[model samples]
Target: MKVLDLQCAHQHVFEGWFGSEDDFHQQLERGLVSCPLCGDLRVEKKLSAPRLNLRAAREESSATRPEGVTLSNHPAQAELVELQGRMLKAMREIMTSTEDVGERFAEQARAMHHGEIERRNIRGQTSAAVALELLEEGVEVMPLPMLPAVKDTLQ
Candidate 1:
């Protein structure tokens, strides 16, 4: 059975199961789809996951993962999950107390270094040139391995 994520004309989301893609198309074209929330017939596939063609010939060229084989999930996966949980918790605590100075990282750091501003925790973005300039001025700055892109959405 093939499972599909479907969205109605009214933006109501639902899932549909079918024997094949052709069966799904046939049912959809005949207005067989009914939105669970509003009971609307106008529905379309929202995000259909790529169907892996399981043709025997194609299988020869592709490296198939053994069904029983998995990662060292018994203990390592648990440890990794625990580590992630701890990191997230720590980050949440820090973000709540820490101040975000945005893009004026260099200027803010300079002010703090020169005692123009009170010394406190600050986070922001800066370019390589700005960072180098700060270093030349003997301003102590180290790059943090920030996970998320705080600047803006990628174009």
Candidate 2:
């Protein structure tokens, strides 16, 4: 298996593993690779340092080892799970605190921007075109994946 470092258009860096360089290139060409953070498909390969395995030749120097450190074989998995947990918690907080404006997201946002309505936190569904238009108009908005329980339709 080959491990390679990759960065998306949004500059979110992550590692991908493949059977070979050809496999990686094939996946990239097929648009199968994407950024986990923002789901961006425009990914680029990054230069990575080579790893050498000499475990059988010599034991790790005790002097250089960190004190009371225990390493996990699946460190990446643990970190990923923790990060996901934190992200979910933040998303939950936002969903709970924001008003569900349903399908009138674009209208409400525009009203707030034009000072026709009071500015407040809101969550709702909007088309990609609408979101782009809002951004182009200098209205700050973020596209967040809402949890099923936070569906604006029920609001």
lDDT by residue (19-138, candidate 1, tens digit) is 898999999889876665456788887654355566763465334544432322225434544565465455556566768898988889999999999998887789988998899999
Q: Write the per-residue lDDT of candidate 2 for residues 1-155, one digit (tens) a residue.
A: 99887778966556788999999999999998877656688999877546556663224632455543323213554465457547756777897799999999999999999999999998789999999999999888999885443332211
- The 10-residue segment with the lowest total lDDT in model 2: 146-155
RMSD of 2: 9.4
RMSD of each: 13.9, 9.4
Off by over 4 Å in 2: 1-73, 149-155
Clashes of each: 0, 0
TM-score of 2: 0.50
In candidate 1, stretches whose alpha carbon ends up further than 4 angstroms from where it belongs are 1-73, 148-155
Best of the candidates, lDDT: 2
